[model samples]
Target: MDLSRPRCRLWRELVLVASLLACGIRQASSQIYITPDSLIGVERYSSSLAIENAPEDVQEYSWHRGANDTEENLIISYNATSHSRRDGPMYSGRESVSIRGTLRIWRSQLNDTGNYTVRVDTINDTQRATGWLEILELEIPQISVNTTSVVDGEDAVAATCYTNDSHVQWYVNHAPVSSNYRMTISPDNKTLIIRMFSRFDSPLQCGIEILPELIQKSDLVYVTVAYGPYSLQLRSSPTDFSGILSAEIGSQVEMECISYSRPESKYRWIHNGSLLSFSEKNITLPSLTWDQMGRYRCIAENSATQLTLYDEVHIQALWRRPVVSRSFTISGSLLVFLIIFTVLGFTHFLMVLIRALFRHYSTRANWSI
Candidate 1:
């Protein structure tokens, strides 16, 4: 649908009169013509219809609300000499005739829309003119928002008041609101512009005045407001410097990451480019070891606004207490002790060998002879 086009409709149509002259059908140009050949009337409003360009010495005029067959419904009649006017019984009070051969209808309704004709009688000739009237039916107005949901930083949003007529008003949470510096309304009072609005604002409505005693307001519509995720920060409870952490073996590790967003936000932690086992806002590693060292990224997402914030972190395990180094030094000491002991034993053996040889040679000469 094209929103810029006018919704109101006023239809006009030509209504030809039936043959009334005794001589047969006559040309339309020879008949008396109404000032406005066709017209449209609004419900409950008064409008007029008149005869014009009639020949001189016109004696009388009679008006009918339908085709020639419906002449009994003579709504109005005028006599030039007596300067008097009369109306039919059906139009006793709602319709009247003017002194100058015109018809006045008050409080027009939908049923009043139809073809009408007027017969003019003069001393020289008789003529007839035909016209039509279309009465418009009023309807209830409606209100619509361009979008049901919007981001906070949007430049503008439109709240439209939809109706056939130009008269309209707006409301917020049942309270009357008008165009201002922050809000603007179109010239036809059909569209309202809003510069900004938060989720805390109230619902909107559109209204119209059907009559002096009745005011019609449309159903309320609530809008949603979305914000962003900002200020992303991630850190461990024990503390680390620029994504570096020092934790001894068999020690528990705890880290907390957060970001700001409206309607809260969802958090995710990634370790070494993979999703961390922990689903909560915090990431924890049990008994920190060298294997835990890697890049840690915390992602914060705002679902409503579809915005995200991320921060990467690196952690390293710092060795505390040189227990293993001291144990390795003791093994080196044992090796040195074993080498010295082996050298001392070898020296003792050489000495024992020399002593044994000396004793055997000294005792062997007398015993063997």
Candidate 2:
């Protein structure tokens, strides 16, 4: 054998050994970390902590209540071989560990706030990770109202927000509310008062900051505001009937009355100052006749506001000139037919008279001869 061949073989063996050592170093240097490094917990709620980059073939998992992984601080432990779990000295009834080395705390309370440590033991090695959780003294916010119904510009409405948090914010129609003559807020911003509640300030709400960037809102509170029978308007279906609608006789007409009111204004119709039989917002005239044409008025009233408003429309009857033109055409045709018949009858009479006279003369002549 040549000496150079042996040297090349020795160099190849050394390169293989270096590659194996690098892979072993990389595996040993891999770090284990915990998910949700920091979290906020609420009472009677659940929170979870999970491990990432943990060693595989984990045979045991141990969770501690504090950052230390001491035996006395162990909250819960799991045996991967038997797939069984045992409670430690610090184990609360709410703590559980998943097969993948995750810690879950149910019905978390204020005392649950602290650093948690998880130690995972695999067939080859062991690793540890820690995370912290904070518990907040918070609950769902609620709104209480003094009265649900109020008259516009005549009555006031008040609402109070109930929550454990003192920092509160008020909203109206989903928009932020501010202190003004019409509306006011309490010093703590918990109570909202409307001096003279209007329909615009409806659907009030309140909210509180539960966390640094999280806000919880209360349910909407609605106030029934009664106002206005104003802006009375009347329109016709054909749309041509307005202030002075000259409709042809026997044409159909539909009239609609509208107004701006909270409780929905009641409608009453009148024709030539006489109240119509129907009190509906809309009225239909199947056939427009002479008697139906006059000043039409719609009266809108609100029971809550005790206000009434009216809109009037003057409708004039048109003589349907097309029918008159048809009648004239028929009369002309009848006159022409009667004249032709009279001329034919006179000519027939003349012919009969001539024939009779001729027969009479012929007989006389014959006798005289």
Candidate 3:
């Protein structure tokens, strides 16, 4: 019985030495660390802060609101041994800690932006890890405008963006809107005003940055501007003619009028300074006569802008002439050759007949003698 007691004491000493060595190795090799040193949090959204490389002998996990692990800044603590959670003095109702020492915040607010610290308590040692979270407010922006339609160089328009986001940007036709003499933006970048609104300032939009890579844009706004009926152009179907159109009588001619204008320009045709009753953009003159030849006018008018412009083209009529072809000349030459050959052959045949008859009559007379 005395020998058994001594063996038991030696076994206990061996077990204690092994446990101490294990603890020393773990403390030296395994360093406690936190994932995502920096986190981006959105208002009214949920996110998490995770810790890695946790000590295997952890007894408790404490999450603090600030960079320090002091009792006053403690948020929530989880007891790894009992598998239970305890709320600290600084804990808000939205915060919770998981068994793996990860901190989760739901329905985050703007005040949640600050440093975060997590304390890991183990049987052998205590360690702390810190991180930073930046909270941003984001919302869908709405555009408000005084008027959606204006006259070029005659009216001014204003557009305002409504959103909870502090950072704002304005765009026109997908390009950034810069402040100039004709356009101005408010100091807060919420309102944009334009004096003498034109077509160049159309398709306006506003946007805000919700996160580092996420951007939210508002509905697009378009403005209608009445412009000019300038650059009057009159074109013909036979585009080869430059200033004047020379047409054969009974031929057809087509004329088209165009101008750069908003709401489309009304066109009229005039011939010899008289209205031709053509109100469309194009006109056709079929079977043109001598009277139709002269100066033709195309009048373009924009009622909204009260601007008028006209283009003119001269037309001359000429009698159609016949065209001789090589085939016709070749046929005439062949006919003349045939007539001359027939005449020569007939004359040769008559001379031979006369000679034969004279010879036969002489032989008959000699035989009779």
Best lDDT among the predictions, by candidate number: 3
- Model 2 TM-score is 0.60
lDDT of all predictions: 0.70, 0.77, 0.78
Q: What does candidate 1 score on TM? A: 0.39
Pick the TM-score winner.
2
Residues 214-300, candidate 1, lDDT per residue (tens digit)? 346778888877776878888785688877877776688888887777768788888898887666778778777777777888888
Which pairs clash (backbone N, Cα, C closer than 3 Å) in model 2? none
Of 2 and 3, the candidate ranking higher by lDDT: 3
**Sorted by TM-score, highest first, which candidate order results?**
2, 3, 1
Structure candidate 1, residue pairs in collision? 243-314
Selected candidate, larger TM-score, 1 vs 2 = 2
Model 1 misplacement above 4 A: 1-142, 162-182, 195-202, 205-220, 239-245, 262-266, 273-279, 302-304, 318-369
- What are the candidates' C-alpha RMSDs? 19.4, 16.2, 17.1
Deviating ranges (above 4 Å) for candidate 3: 1-40, 43-51, 54-137, 212-214, 240-242, 319-369
Clashes of each: 1, 0, 0
Angstrom error of the Cα, residue 303, model 2: value is 1.0
